[model samples]
Target: MKMVKLICVLATLLLPHLAQANPIRIKDLVEFDGVRSNDLVGYGLVVGLNGTGDGLRNSPFTEDILGNILERLGVNVTGEQFRPNNVAAVLVTGALPPFARTGSSLDVTVSAIGDASSLLGGTLIMTPLKAADGDIYAVAQGTIIAGGASAAGDGAAVIQGVPTAGVIPSGATIEREVAFDFSGLSTVRLALRTPDFTTAERIERAINAAFSRHVAVMLDAGTVELDIHATQMRSPAHALGRVENIMVEPERRARVVVDQRSGTIVMGEDVRISRVAVSQGNLTLRIQEAPLVSQPNPFAEGETVVVPRTDVDIIEEPGIGLAEVNGGTSLSEVVAGLNALGVAPRDMIDILKSIKASGALHAEFIVR
Candidate 1:
């Protein structure tokens, strides 16, 4: 009977610490479906350069493409030695945004694929950007706007950022649009990026409360099902438009993340320790080299001799009193507890690893 009373007292003492953690926002937890963009890529030419474009003799593709363009313009120079110095073959890439129309313009990124030195002061010609379906979706062309600088001396060169690539704002006109019918669906599903049952339930509740209708139903940890019939809306898009905007508290696991190279540590607010005693210290070994000279007996003719010797020493930091890290129920408390140890971020990572190994850290430890 005495042991049972002690257990109950301990549970009562720990309950308050466990209830201090707060939930995160739902927008940071889930991703909406069908709200994505497609990638479009094309090979293009950038001309009107100032002696910095590709060497026509070295790059056969550039020569062939330029020659073909001249031929199409009714210039009969087939037998003439054709060499120009103002063009570079580049690869253009851009994203085809959702709901883009035939005349919509998007920014395109042009990068030199050849051995060109730079793409400064160049104008990209009309290039057809294609999708994976072997169809052109956008046509890219404009003056390049590179955000970099380069300079060279006799023996050294300094460059900043990217010198061979640039982006043109609204440079590409959409030639075709994809056919994704969003309103024709009988049912819609929401897939949470980081799946959690609590979050899924909260999302369902938030959607139902916004419309005052139980249209959303939790299907699993990662997905929620919404019945179109229950929304009482005019269309599926109309129902999702209202449901996606509803906000709710999110759920996440306690995590302790550390970056070894950058010496950066990120811990979730829920990360905690369970009454663990910690002691961190470092041992340093140092050595010094010196040369010693010795002469045989002083008066008589003696050969002087020298020998090298090294002095070694070991140092161990003084012990800090055994400190107990109390269980942290919030992120701020967790950081305060860790900072109290007076250790650098690099050393703290090692200490965190040891704590995790001992099963005292109540969180997922991820080393990256």
Candidate 2:
């Protein structure tokens, strides 16, 4: 009887902490089905480079664009052979955000598509941005803010950032809108970023509970259907505004993510480990080649001879004995056990992989 009471008390104490660990807003975990961004792309010309533009001989496209621009502006250059070094051909791209109105401006990205040396201090000429359906959506024209720069002197050069790409704030004016009527929709779908059966059920329950009714239904592990008509709300937007703030405890799978290039290791809070013994050792091999030149002694007739010597050595660092890592019941204990190994992040990654292979790490191992 006493032990049962003690266990109950412990459970009561841990419940709040566990609940606080996973509280997340619905907005962070899911996206509305119809609320999205549209891609806009355009081909344009960037001028005003300081002799860092495309070479006229190599990149004829730059010259062609310049000629066309001049002709469009009432200047005839049909047979001109002048070589200009202050212009470059570029591609402008941007996203037309959801519900963007006509005449609204958007930030656009400009990138040099030719052999231009740099896009620094360049201005994007007026260009028509088109969507995938071949309809003009926006007109982009502004001064480029290149994120990088480059400099060269004689035989040496120092460059920082990317001078061949840039961004212009509010550079594109929206000329058209996507054919989506948000007000006519009676139902909205929520798409989970990371789908799980438990998470879907939780979201459904939380949304329904907030309204004291069953307006939300879990269609699948990745989707939840919300009935806008049944809510009797002013609009779908009103319902979403109220529903997105309702916090729910999200469920996540136990996993360990490792990035080899960056030497980064990330383990989920739900990760677990069984009782395991680990040992680590490093072996290194070294090879040295030295050639000796021997001269004929005191003007002897024999030509100088060369002798080659090679040295090889193998060294192994002393490894720790098989240290037992206790099975952990919580994330903190698991982290503490791994920290006790006193290994580098990369070494820890290898050890985790070995543990996973041995079936002692109770989580999925993802290598990136």
Candidate 3:
């Protein structure tokens, strides 16, 4: 009984501290300055489609590329006027990851650029992907596994997902490596995904404490420079590997985000609200038209007359009386106070907006 009582007492004391601070790995919070991905794109051809390819007449570029491919294959048909229904023109795209070496494979996406109905079960021809510098970095070729399927009859058609785009896993081979001298660098920068002065200061302190020296300096709210020579590590790479795993508690601003389209409300732990009163009701107006025709004495008279009539009604739903929401010092209290009105999500969104307008909500309100 004593051991159980001690365990409960410890849990009660530790729960509040655990809830107040959440330490996340620095790697997940910051992006290494030179560690990034590059985008590569290329124009290619997809063939063997099931009659759902581009129409040569509508998309003449498809025919031009096809002729070029055939000419390169020693096919001598200079004046041939042939149109095939099993070919498509596509744009291939992929991202070259950081530290990628030669002969590394990358996943590529094939998207139909012409009027192709679908790329399902299509084979992409060998295409060289180029970077922004107009240098060929990789070559991509593989069978496309389209995300969608399509079917049609004479009058109607049905397509699920996107049939014009597909992905090929590990479809491209890297031919060249990006030139970067990581081991020669003297200092490296850590770029925060979200800039905050307090978070930056905390990160600086955490790194310095870990190394037992001032190795990191906060340049600004978004950047922190690390002195690699001070760490006495083998290289900048080694220094970064050690710093990336260090846990640091980050600070976030109080915010309440609401999506009007889906009626979603998301409040941060720091969100607070002052005491306020709210009332909500709905108003509905309905108009109905009724037309009447009158015949004169069973066709005794030659003319008939028509009359139009309309009925309009206005309805106002019973509204909840003005309810008081007490000021909240914590997230749970704020949620509980607002929920006391027993309103629907859509109505609650309006109430939050009103509270913000009245300067009672002590947080940034974002409506999307």
Candidate 4:
């Protein structure tokens, strides 16, 4: 009882701070337009495996790619039949970060697309990475770092991690740059990660206060327009350096999120609930079969007979009385009322759902 009182006291003291939003840097709240990553993909091959490569008869693509590579290297094998267990076909993927320059290296992932057992100890051949526009942007070639291993015998096999997929750090070199001029822009638009009118207005106010002028304007709930000329700065880069560090409070709607698979329930501090009642109970059934065998005496010459017996039962455990929760205005009051029910997390999930259905819960209910 004393510990419960102490917790309640702590929660009551923390509600005031929770009622107001905390200050977050502008960089964390919004995303700058044209500052993002682009995905690049390519088809490639990996060699130097220890008999773990794809079979020629089953994977025709692997053999075809090998023949093409050999032909590119000035090897004459037009009519020659080659069978080797040291090659595999793979798909390579990587991300080209914004502002990436020519010759910059990026990490690439290689995943087997054929019937290969493993990619361990294999080296990727030169492959060209292409963007969505069908233009070559980078070239990848490096050793593979597989994440898992496996071992097999005649009858039994054991596998640990994934052996058919791996990553090559700094394997791809950028050849072309995405067309985006970051320095020549006169106005920079800030897109909110989570759109909210209160948060956008607060950001505008914070920026104008920092510059001591009306340099920032709230265009909408999700966009904030900043004028680079009003700051009298050298460039947008310099203006960003000064503005991105300023802290502004962000607002969020009252929400409750639940994960059914993991039995997790998360509620925002702004969530509220009206008066409600909840009850829970469980019923179980059981059945058992038993048989008895009988035999005549040795000299009686009578056949054996079996008798069957069965037992059945139904049980109903007594359930607690319906618990009542009064209307709450703050998060602490709501939590304290719910905690009084003495129910499991999953059980509470059902109760909360029922409450929401009856129009008691005033927050957004999300199930994942």
Tell me each candidate's TM-score.
0.82, 0.92, 0.93, 0.88
What number of backbone clashes does candidate 4 have, counting pairs of residues 3 or more apart or in separate chains? 1
Candidate 1 residue 86 C-alpha distance from true site, Å: 3.5
Cα lDDT tens digits, model 3, 212-270, are 99999999999999999999999998999999999999988899898989777877777
- Which of 2 and 3 is ahead in lDDT? 3
lDDT of each: 0.81, 0.88, 0.90, 0.89
- Whichever of 3 and 4 has more TM-score, that candidate is 3
| Per-residue alpha-carbon lDDT of candidate 4 for residues 1-368, written as tens digits (9 for 90 to 100) | 33334435666888898877689999999998778899999998999988888998999999899999999999978988998898999999999999899999999999999988899999999999999999999999989999888788999988888999999999999999999988898899999999999999999999999999989999999999999999889999999999999999899899988888867777777899999887777677999998889999998988999988888999987654688899989888987887787666776788789999999999999999
Clashing pairs in 3: none
Q: Which candidate order results from sorting by TM-score in descending order?
A: 3, 2, 4, 1
Ranking by lDDT: 3, 4, 2, 1
Q: Is candidate 3 or candidate 4 better by lDDT?
A: 3
191: Cα error in model 1, Å: 2.1
What would the per-residue lDDT of candidate 1 be over residues 1-368, giving only the tens digit for each residue?
Answer: 23223323444566477566544544456655675689999998899988778887789898787777778789877878866777899999999998798999999999998777778889998899999988999999999998786777899988888879999999999989999887777688888988989889998888888778778889999988888778888998787777766667778688878889977776665678877889878888999999899889968887999989999999987644577788776655666666677666677788889899999898999988
Model 2 regions more than 4 Å off: 1-22
Instruction: Give the best candidate by lDDT.
Output: 3
